[model samples]
Target: MEKLIDCHFHIWDLDANYYPWLTDNVSENVTKITGDYSSIRRNYLVEDFRKDIGDLNVVAAVHVQADADPKDSVKETQWLQSVADGSGNGMPQGIVARGALNADNAEEIIEAHCACPNMRGMRVEMHPGLNAPADYNPLKDEKWLRNFALLQKHDLVFEVRAASPEQTKDVIQLMRDHPETNFVFPHLALSIWRDEEAIAAWKRNIKIFGELPNAYIKLSGYGLFGLGWTTEMVRPYVMDVIDAMGPDQVVCGSNYPVDSMAAPYSRIWETHFQLLDDAGITGADRAKILHDNGKRVYKL
Candidate 1:
C-alpha cells in the first residue's frame, strides 16, 4: 500500500505550444534558470511522471505552478485537469496555477484558474533571479499586497518561492502581514547555501518563518542549483528544516521535472526518505511529514 501524496511536481508538453518558459527562445534567454535544463526540455506528461515514481506508492500528487507564460497559466491548470481525468485515479488531485500578483488583471487570471475543477491555489514566482523582473519588489509593492488580498477573499493558499536568502526575508515578512491566508513555502524555505554565515542566517530565518502558524513548508527542489544528488548532500538541510518547521508544518515534495535536472525521481525521494529515517521520524509523525500533512495542507 503506497501512501504518499507528493505536494510539488510538474507535467508539461513543449510541443503543445503553451509553456513559453520551456520554449526555445525563452530557454536561451533565461539560461540561468538552472545550470542545464536541456535534459528536461521535452514533453513530460502524467505517464512519464508515474514511470519516474516507480513503486514509490504515490497515492496522489499536487502539481505546483510551472513558469508558463502568464497568459497561459489557466491553460496549464486545464491541461493538468485533463491529465488527471485521463489517468482515472487522479495523479494530480490539486493544481496550483501561476498568477502574476502585480499584473493589472490579476483577479481575472486568478478567477480563470479557480474556475478549473482541480485548481487548489495560486503561485507567484518572485524567486529574485536573472529571470525575475528587475523592477518587481513583491514584498513591499502595493500591487502585490492588493492582489494578495484577493487570495484571502477567495480562500486560496499563496505558494511562495524564495530563490535566495534575501528573498527568504521578504517571504517571512509577507507571511507575518497576511496571517489570514494559508501559505505553502516550497524548496526548504528556498535556503540552499554553502557558506557558514549564509547557513546560520537561513537557519535563523527558518525559525522565524516556522513560528508563524499560518504556513507550511514543502521540502522539495534540491540539486537544481548546482547541489549534488547524494544523501550526504541533502542530509543536513533536511534535518535542519524538520527541526525548524517541525513535522506538523513540513510536508514532503518531489519537485519533479525541475528536480529531474539534478537527479531522478527515485533518487530524490530516497534521499528525502532516508533523511527522515536518520532523524528518527517514524510512525504517524513520519507519515505526517511524508503524506498526511500534504493532504491536510492542500485539502486533498
Candidate 2:
C-alpha cells in the first residue's frame, strides 16, 4: 500500500447550517466556489471521506475551506478539529480556512483561524466569470495587499484561484510582491490545455509562479471545467506545470467530493499516479508530490 498526505478533501455537515450552497433545495445545478455543482448536494462528513478513501493509505489530510459562510469559517475549522479529535483516523491534520483578504476584519479572522492548532492557512476564490461584485475585485487593491501580507507575519499560507489565465497573470505581481508568504495555486490554475493559445498563456503564467520560491501549485481538479477530464486531456498541461514548478514545488490533492462527481476518489488518484508515472517522475520525487510537499507546505 502507498502512503500519502492527501493535501485536499472536503467534509461538510448539512445539519450545521454553515454551508449556504449545500441547501437541500438544490435539486438543480448550483454554482459554489468551483462551478455548476449539482451532484454534491448531499451531506458529507468525516465518515463519508473515510469510506471514499478506503485503504488508500492516507497518512493525513488537509481540509481546505468548503465555502461555508465566512463568518463561520473559524468555527468550521473548530468543528473539523473536533472531527479529527474523534475520528481516530489520523486524517485532517491541517486546514485552509476562508477569509476575505480585502475585508477590514481580515486580520481578526486570520488570527482567529491561526489560534486553531490544525489551521494551516486561508484561501480566497475570485470568480471573475460571474462578475462577482466590487469586493471580489480586491486582488490589486493596496488594502487587500496590506491584509494579505499579514499571512507572512503569522506564518500562514495563501491559496487562490482565478477564473482565467489572464487573471492568473494579474496575481504574478502579488506573488513576487509577497515573498515571505507562501502561496498555493490549485488545479493547474484552471488551465485549459486542450487549446493551444490557452495552454501557451497558462505556461507563461505558471512560469512566473515557478520563479517565485514561495508559490506552490496543486495537481488536482483535472476535470473542474465540466469537460470530464482524462489523463490524455490533462497530461501535457500537468507535465508543463511540473516542468515550470518542478516536483518539489508541486503537491497533489484529491479535490475529493467535488472531483468525485466526475470520477471516483480511487480513480482520481489512480489516474494522477498514471500521469506521474508516464512523466518519469522518480519514486522519491513521487513521494514528495504525494506526501512530503503537502506536509512541508501545509506544515502538517
Candidate 3:
C-alpha cells in the first residue's frame, strides 16, 4: 500500500484561543476534546512524518482549514508552509485557508489569502449549525458567487463542508454554474448522520456531481458520526462513498484533532486501511486515494 497523505488534518493550540465547539461538559455523547498539541509537534512535523511513513511516501498534503480566528487561518498556513519548506516535507503542498465566502467583501478576502504562495484553495465552513443561515445558500447570494468567481479567477480549488444533503445540492449547483472552479467536498458531505432515505438521496446526488470533472470528494470524518469507536463500524459508509465516487476522484483525510477526540490518531489511520482493504482496491488506486489525488487537486 502507498503511504497515506492525510489531507484533512487540523492543528491548533487551545491556549491561544477559545474553540467554542470543544465544550468542557458534554450533554451529547460526543467525544471529549483531548487538546493535545504535543503529538502533533512531536509526530506530524517533517521528521516525524518521515518516521511514521517509513518506506511509504507522502507526495503532498492539503491543510484543511480549522475553525479558528480568520487571521490565524492565514498565519497557520504560513507556519505550516514554512515547516514543509524547511523540512523538505513537501512544502505543505496546498493550503485551504478559512474565509467567509458569503460576506459582502468575500472576493477581497479570497484575494488576500491567495496572495500566499502556499494558499491553493479556500475552505468555507458552511455548517448551518455553526455558521449563519445565509451562508448555507451559496448560489442564492450574489456575494457568494462573486467570491466563487474570484476563486475561479485565481484557479483556487473550493473545499466545502455542509451539514445537510440539500446543502450538497446547492454546492453542486454552484460548481456547475462555475465549471472552471474545482470543488472538493469534504467528509462525504457530512452524510454519516443521515437516515437511510437521506443516505440514498445523498448517494444519488453525489453520483450526479461525480459526473462533473472538476468535482472531488474527500473520504474523511466518518468516525465522528457514530458513538462507537471502531473502524469496522465506519466501513460500510466509507465503502459506499468509494463505490459511488470511485477511488480516482476520492482522497484520504484524517480530520485529526477533531477526530482524535473519538479515537486515537493510530486508530484513525487503521480505520482508513480497513476501509481500503475491505473494498479490495488495487495498490495504484489506493495510492491515488492515499496521496496522488490530493497532490493533483492541491497542485502539490
Best by TM-score: 1
Tell me the whole-model lDDT of each prediction, alpha carbons only.
0.78, 0.78, 0.67
**Model 2 clash tally, residue pairs:** 0
Model 1 agreement with the true structure over 70-134: per-residue lDDT tens digits: 65777778777777888636868989888688889989988888887778888876755535677
Q: Which whole-number lDDT from 0 to 100 does residue 69 have in model 2? A: 70
* Backbone clashes in model 1, listed as residue pairs: none
- Supply the global lDDT for candidate 2: 0.78
User: Global CA lDDT of candidate 3, please?
Assistant: 0.67
lDDT of 1 at 238: 80
Give the per-residue lDDT of model 3 (tens digit) for 1-300. 466677876554445443334423331222222334333331234454445444545555667766555545556566666665776456466788886767776776766677678888887766554445644555566776666677888888888765466666677778788888888878765543467889778778778766887888887775556535576666676777788778878888867655654666566666777788889977788888887888788887
Ranking 2 against 3 by TM-score, winner: 2
Q: Higher-lDDT candidate among 1 and 3?
A: 1
Q: Write the per-residue lDDT of candidate 2 for residues 1-300, one digit (tens) a residue.
A: 667877778898877646766774442324544466767877888889889888788888899888777566778877887787877354689988886777788888888888878888887766544324744566656887788778888898888855455566567777778888888988877543347788677777778878889888888886575547677877887888889998889998888888887888888788878988988987789999888999899998
**Sequence-dependent TM-score of model 1:** 0.91
Model 1 deviation from native, Cα RMSD in Å = 2.1
> How far does residue 220 in candidate 3 sit from its true spot (Å)?
1.2
